[model samples]
Target: MKPFRRRSLLAAGFSAILSVQHVLAIQLDLQSTDSIKAAAKTLAGDMVSYYTGYRPGDVPGNLPSPYYWWEAGAMFGALVDYWYFTGDDTYNAITTQALLHQVGPDKDFMPPNQTKTEGNDDQAFWAMAALSAAENKFPDPPEDQPQWLALAQAVFNTQAARWDTTSCGGGLKWQIFAFNTGYNYKNTISNGCFFNMASRLAVYTGNQTYADWAVRMWDWCSAIGLRDAQYNFFDGSDDNLNCSQLDHIQWTYNAGTFLVGAANMYNFTGGSQEWADRLNGIIGNLKLFLKNNVVYEQACEPVGTCNVDQRSFKAYLARWMAATAVKAPFTYSLLKPILEASATAAAAVCTGGVNGTSCGLKWTEGTFDGSIGVGEQMSALEVIQSNLIDIVSGPVSQDSGGTSKGDPNAGTSSDIGPSDLNVGEVTTADKAGAAILTVLLIFFVAGGAWWMVT
Candidate 1:
């Protein structure tokens, strides 16, 4: 960056533009990340400030009124990541408040006594967030504050009692109530989230029982075609009770939960090629959440419409996909470019409201069409936050054909996966200059979205 080197970058041909582009790219990346960082902090603040409350349906950044258990749980998961990425205390405070209100007298998260909606899957979502907070060492509020790990454990215990082997070779049913629509359905979200939670708990507590459960869940899910050979995750099997039919609809969160579990299994015990392959396979199909390589909900988007749960799905996918990078660094090279490409696309879609900054469901980069809400805000916040993780972890190489050796201390990781909820610094490989540049150009085009918001 000396004067001569700077001038040398500015020659008059296509070569010159390409030569100087790298220099410009550096400034642009910093701007983009800065914008992302600032936006994550502010939007998170806005969500908590405006939407969440003592009522059942009040969690900000969730779709559908009167509070849905899983959606609120999903929002808390993102809040946990925001805490780790930026050390923002507000997210922590809100999370504590939300949990305090939601965790009922029995320590099950009933949420304002909305017991009818308390599916095991819905309840486990809260536990997953608490486990994440516990892993990160988020301070307990007071002695009065529920212990995070204890809350998560309680959730697991609740699910364990419901495991029915009588049908479909054993998977947790979607609903706790026998008469509910999904009651007989052994769905992927319930089983998948349980798999992820079991994997984390196996590492955290060094309990073979938890590890065994993780293994069991993985086997059942794979055998049932919920987590299939193609790495294409299907929605849960319907309530025919036979488990022979698969729903086949895919969601961002399904991949998120299953891949994170696979990555955790790889990290915790090592030499699980099956697990390693599963992780790679899912990473390969991440375009399920992307459009032209930029991440999208893939279910309801570009039409600028998404249903209650679908609107909030991408945040979990983005959050845990970043986690997968940490849990299996060997895959870092594979994950980085896709994530950066998507983040850059996300930055572009956020525009033309709130000081030229509005978040919309459609990620296909055009000016924002004036639709804005909590779910849109969070979808943008989570993706941008992952981009920040990319910058910190630095350049990553795709892990090639070599077998995964895993962590040297797989035994220790088996007991305590990762460092306090950290993704750890992913090692760099050869830089993907073009990919990074593509990201920067999109951010440059959408530069005002970030800058004008503040």
Candidate 2:
């Protein structure tokens, strides 16, 4: 069937799933995974519609003019989770193609075209997508293509090399190149991503080096006050000021990144109390983003000033927190109600847009706030599908059935393409088509052993 026809049918069929009283909203029966999957299918379909990158005359790894290259990476990551949780392969082919096409010459996601604007965080998001692919056991790429584990490790290796020690003691600068805006700042998202990636890599590959890097990043963040006494992770600090002052803005993704990273560390150390305290601290502080149990962009939602990028912050937090529940196990009870409430609110706000099911940025409103974008749709999709967290098995590692190959020295090469090109400019649009693991953990659940370790 044609795309429009499928959307129309899906929109028309929403009535059967929605509650009669809340007919204007997409109401989900959170207790039922089938109901959750149905809602997720609708949200994911709507979310992927915003992408034009896969079409003729478009860049394969990009969304459009307004959406940045990094978000496209993040969206694909969410879709990977969508497939993992719901068993929907609807978006897999396109997702695979998009991921492979953007691997760049070095396969570190530093595609030559994106070097102008790519930051540590931007590249890390794409690496996170590859990380998600490895963890979720998404179908591996063809033997000739870049494997998922290698791609993630390449990114880790390159970024690990970029961890600057000259300023603020140690941390990654916001941007990769000195000319890019925000280059003088060192942000939590950038370093938190590294920490998250490293912790998971350690769990997956059983590498002490990656775990050491994870601990170092966490300590640097804390020592520099990016993570405050209350464990509230602020935004970036100015390296020009010698890291004396922070941006003080608390974005959900910042906390979410560190949250999962801490969870993995907690799991990696065999449930150490130190990591547990850090996990609980971050989780407690995250309540600042919650309003009556639903997740909201507290930094910008109330002011009606959320920019395009800020709008998608909730998606990462929702997904990361859900991942934390699985990785840590102990946090499941604490995280569940918040996620469930947010998912319901997210669905309720899907009453907007042409199809009357497009999500909005503010879930606190309890109604569609007339906002719509890839971010809104993605936030809704992730939160809805994450309801499957408990039912579905958690991520896998090489010790388990994971099949993605790794390269410890992957991104250490000095042969990456030049860094002067336009952010999303694809030189040869003709060759667009292509194709595209963590850890062992042992948890004691109710006096019984929960074997997350393969």
Candidate 3:
């Protein structure tokens, strides 16, 4: 069948499977169309309240209490993804506003006084969202707004300088500066983010340098054993720079971030066999994260102990699976079962809105676990939006509705809020309060067994 004919038929036939496709999606792409549609409906309804905590007008520095730049960045990245996947412009402002608030004068992302909290990894997280904005042309900012593409490039430039070739055959460090203990740490996330960003930038710029960086980052990651033969990514080896002594810990995002990078490199290389092998190997390794075909934070949460960060990790894995699935038809069919189950179950976990419409963590249980917070809401949003990508782009003959030619990311775009508003100018008292709040995050990062381990 021709592409449009297939898409049109799929569009009309889309209604055929909503209530019944979950079981059949494992066998066919047409069946999963309904699953994605069904999942998108629930996400559209809850997105407003789910994002209420992160808006700029309401909170100090325009962030909710227990502010985390990295998590907020990921949340915004997911929202931009939703906009691109569905062309729903309602989310455009929120994603733009929140991100603009963080882009300082340097084009580097640090939300003002919270500099102590963000490392190279944290900044990369925010930059990841910016890159998504650049790739998809989510929305053009209004006149007198930050140029999303330039901001993303500024981030890449900063990261490129920090790519330490001296360390274990070359990779990025966990911290951008030396003040913190993580400065020398060559972790999966820092380099994974670099790999992902570089891969994406290569596609956006048609720049061979970006492509080279992507290849180099992945090679180093594998050489260091951070990405092992099985393609599973371990947590960072602490500050040694030797790239030996793989920490051997696992997290959904560590492995997940690398997959998208690999996929992009595959696409950029015009489907090179080397990148293809890496993509397939990475996907095969991700099987360890599944339970009965549903994705989970496998190493944690089964014992009722997913900490602040781990609770949200699987969302990224779901996201990249759908993002790259458009390029890998085989991987799409293989991965859609988990996406379908995750979207349905994740939607069913909501129970805390004005009348029980919000979502919570522990989505696999299909019901709220008596907890409600920003991280859980962010996680659910990521996967729910993820399903939309699969619906429009996965395993079907359609132009990638989510992206286009020549990186249509020129000119400055406006924001939803005041452009000049800084993130936080903390007073002594606010610093004290933020200090207490930062403890939970610090403990969370230090692995109260939280192996999303940055």
Best-fitting candidate, measured by lDDT?
2
Local accuracy by lDDT, each model: 0.67, 0.85, 0.66
Pitting candidate 1 against candidate 3, the one with the higher TM-score is 3
Checking candidate 2 for backbone clashes, the offending pairs are: 134-437, 135-437, 141-436, 203-439
Where model 3 places Cα greater than 4 Å from the true spot, the runs are 1-62, 352-354, 390-454
Give one digit per residue, the lDDT tens place, for model 3 in 1-454: 8999999998778654432333322121225655444444455445445455332223211335454667767777777777766666776655666676667645567544455666767888888887777666666565466666667666777777666766576777786545445666788888888888888877667678889888888877877788878887998885463766778879889888888888878877888888888888888887788766667777776787777667768778887887777655556776777777776676666655444545667777766676556566666767766666644433211133423223223212322111232244446787687788755644443232122110
TM-score of 3: 0.76
User: Mind giving the per-residue lDDT tens digits that candidate 1 earns over 1-454?
Assistant: 7988776666546465444433322111434657667767766764554353433334322334644767777777778778767666776755676665566656656443344466778888888887777665666545644667767777776676667776888888887655345666888989999999888777666567878899999898988889878888888886475888998988888998888888888877863787788788998888767777677777667555577668778778877777788878888788767667766666566653434455666766644545566666677778778767755532111132211111212222122111221222223431255356535643453233222211
What TM-score, over all chains together, does every model reach?
0.75, 0.87, 0.76
Candidate 2 per-residue C-alpha lDDT over 1-454 given as tens digits, one digit per residue, 9 for 90 to 100: 9999999999878865554325645759998888999899888888988997665445566888688989999999999999999888998987887888788767889776665578889999999999999999999988888899999999999888887777899898888876577878899899999999999999899899999999999999999999988998899899999999989989999999999999999988999999999999998988799999999888889999999999999999999999999999999999999999999888878887767788888888877788999999999998889889888877999898788899999998843222421154233332232110001110122112111100
lDDT of 3 at 384: 65
Whose TM-score is higher: candidate 2's or candidate 3's? 2
lDDT of 1 at 290: 72
TM-score of the candidate numbered 2? Answer: 0.87
The whole-model C-alpha lDDT of candidate 2 against the native structure comes to 0.85
Model 3's C-alpha root-mean-square deviation from the true structure amounts to 13.0
Give stretches of model 1 more than 4 Å off.
1-33, 54-67, 302-305, 352-355, 390-454
